[model samples]
Target: MSDHPHPPSFDENILKKVEALQEKYAAMGQDLNAYLDGLLHADYLTYWDYINLDTLLSLQHPITPFPDESIFIIYHQITELYFKLALHELDQLNTSASKDPDLILKRVSRVNRYFEALTHSFEIMVDGMDQDQFLKFRMSLLPASGFQSAQYRMIEIRSTSFDRLLREEVREKYEDHAPGDLEELYSHIYWKAGAVELATGKKTLTLRQFEVKYDRTLLELAENTFEVNLRSLWNGLPVAAQTDDLRQALRWLDTNVNINWPLSHYKSAVRYLQRDPEDIAATGGTNWQKYLPPRFQRRIFYPELWSEQELANWGKGWVEKEVFGVK
Candidate 1:
């Protein structure tokens, strides 16, 4: 018969992959042919279905009729998504047995990129909203402040030593504390002061609500990440492996998160809430004046990474330039 030899069922590479997959499934006590049959019958994946696009679009149900509230909701949703990406990078390092400095640098670089995006994009929150609509609708969503973001708190916990997160006034008291002392330390966590009711000297309903939902979970994460958090990992790195690029990334991350981000919020607060007679109280009575400025918190994730003068001048220049239009 005039014919080329019948073509082999699959090319050599495909056949090799199938063989490897069969071996893999056999090790796991699976029937490879059954899995192959399921794959053969499966529908082609659509982009929207793969990403759950319809479900994601349906999540925003603004509590008030004000159209600007929709902007607020969507922007916060976008922020949480970015935070999720940052944590995903950190979690890989935290869970891995390898303390390879290059891996840490790679993940840190990715996280820094995410925060840079967030810091730049915060202009949307600052200037995009109709302040009148925002102030009107924001009250309807009272006691529920952006201060209640558990993911932001989780980023702090995952980023550095828990002691670094303590209020400056109380941090010295717990300077020599042990791991079991997390409860006491957490009680004085810096952000809590920001969430207090100005007149009553008590925790705001916003902070109280957040504590109920996240206290145990966050404490557990803190305990688990104690040895594996970014600061600890950086400290553990051999001096030779601590490249200048890595140091720069870490420093940029600290500035982006602690200074630039808070100042961005401060800018938004002044834009909407600052008034002629008396500046408006923020949602949930958050002490924005006390809370949003970096000079007050002075929360340095990596103290050893800075000079004494740098530490003294922390958050000062950024605040003057961004908040006050200083040169």
Candidate 2:
């Protein structure tokens, strides 16, 4: 005690933590001192750095001089981030070993919540931007369109079997191939029909550019998710887990993605771009009148879950009234 000053009595909690850390490192074939050295050099994490606030705020590089252009960029970036979040949940659903119903419901709920947010906020696109500026700036973005969003495509792939996402005609055509053939499966996806030239029925520059940039990656993703998609995973759940609540949740998710979101988006297009007599073509040069409306596409993610009437109704009456002003 006199020589070493009582050896500097340590707190019991601190001593216990140190001993636990030493044992943990020992079991892992590491030295606690080596980790302590690294910790000594580590910088304290800041909120800005932890969230990458600076880099995230720097992403909105609008081409035009209009202030609203930044809004457009930022909103799409936000949407993509939401899509990324949804994909994170989907990935967890796809990889889970147990296929726990509670977990699946939780994840699908998250994805639906994200889509619901987008659906509700699509008014930002319809009304937030000045029409004149949006029209003017849209010309600067020639081939790039929301249709080109690869993450959106990935979400669809993870949500259902590729066959369900295809037009029945397209599905029948590819029925000869092995069920999981990536190239064949993706060839029939419904979105391939979008962004086409109405006059010539050829692929639009928008579609061509999208294919060039994403076709390979999409094929790979489709291959990976072919058997593990949301519908397949849901079918794998215990019969008790397919309760009415869960069924309604899944149905809402299906309609949110395939109908409600698209319908809202189509309304925005109509609001901004639908000039009477001859509506302005979309920036992507598609027959968006045909492409954007859900009734014409009828892209259902889960077919067996819906009855004949629901399938027949699809996106019919409500969409016609809201989007096209039909009686």
Candidate 3:
């Protein structure tokens, strides 16, 4: 009864925030009252709903009833998700004008880590499945090869320009051409050579279908990424930001993606698909023995970052010894 004016029970900070929000909305010509009313009815965010876990789990639709088929589907889905996450970081790098060296290094390191994880976990393909089951069920997946992974291609495009991705023999020809001639440039990408049928000298249906679906999209991506590519972005950084740590990160990324990952993938193909005299043609009908080897493809993303000896021996020694048990 002897109380001076009683204080309100609610947080004063929250009340202040509401007032600030109201002022902010009003300044922007928005209806603050309506928004506040809607906020009153909103439920708290749940982890499952926020991530859409149910929908993600529902995406594993295996065409074959084979038990291991889901394993194949899920692992590829996981790889795609990882690729998407890497692309998210790349997209930020592409759009950012912050010029923060630490931030650039962090993004590059994150991408390098992603590729490293992919390179290491490729054992999931090499040894995860029963070889007989893989070879048997693969027949059901005709014209649908991992070669058609558009995100992998997008990652390559974002990493460097198209010429950097060309076969070594023709890189000079494409580099000397008009910069805007992406159509002509796209025609000569190393994969085109990979997908050409050996006897008939025609494009494989896998590559043809891939072109039909993604050629325009890839062209657009190439144009968008030409200047904003990771190499260009690194080059744009202030000279002081280009430290040894950054250079090592770039070189490691280049080697992991181009060499380690390719060698791992080629080993898996050899394990499950090779038949001695002639290896089995991949589902994409690619001459994989010729195409998959990094020594032949020489897909160096950051050529300026490597030394003459490193460039001369790209993926030659350790990969050969480790993958093939070569003396």
On lDDT, the candidate that comes out on top is 1
* lDDT tens readout by residue for model 3, 159-245: 887887776787877764445887778877777777666667788888899899998998889888777888877778878888888
Candidate 1 structure lDDT: 0.86
TM-score of structure candidate 2: 0.90
Model 3: weakest 10-residue lDDT segment is 276-285
Candidate 3 lDDT: 0.81
Highest TM-score, which number?
A: 1
Give the distance in Å from residue 47's predicted Cα in candidate 3 to where it truly belongs.
Answer: 1.6
**Least accurate stretch of 10 residues (summed lDDT) in model 1?**
276-285
Q: How high is the CA lDDT of each candidate model?
A: 0.86, 0.83, 0.81
lDDT of 2 by residue, 1-327 (tens): 266556678899999999999999999999999999999999999999999999988877889899999989988988999999999988876576637777777888999999999998988988899988888888888878898999998999898877777765776566445555757667777888888887878998889989999998988877777668888888877798787767877898899999999999889888987775333654544678888888888888887799999999999887878777889
- What's the TM-score of every candidate structure? 0.92, 0.90, 0.90
Error of 2 at 83 (Å): 0.4
Q: What is the lDDT, from 0 to 100, of the residue 204 in candidate 3? A: 86
Of 1 and 2, the candidate ahead on TM-score is 1
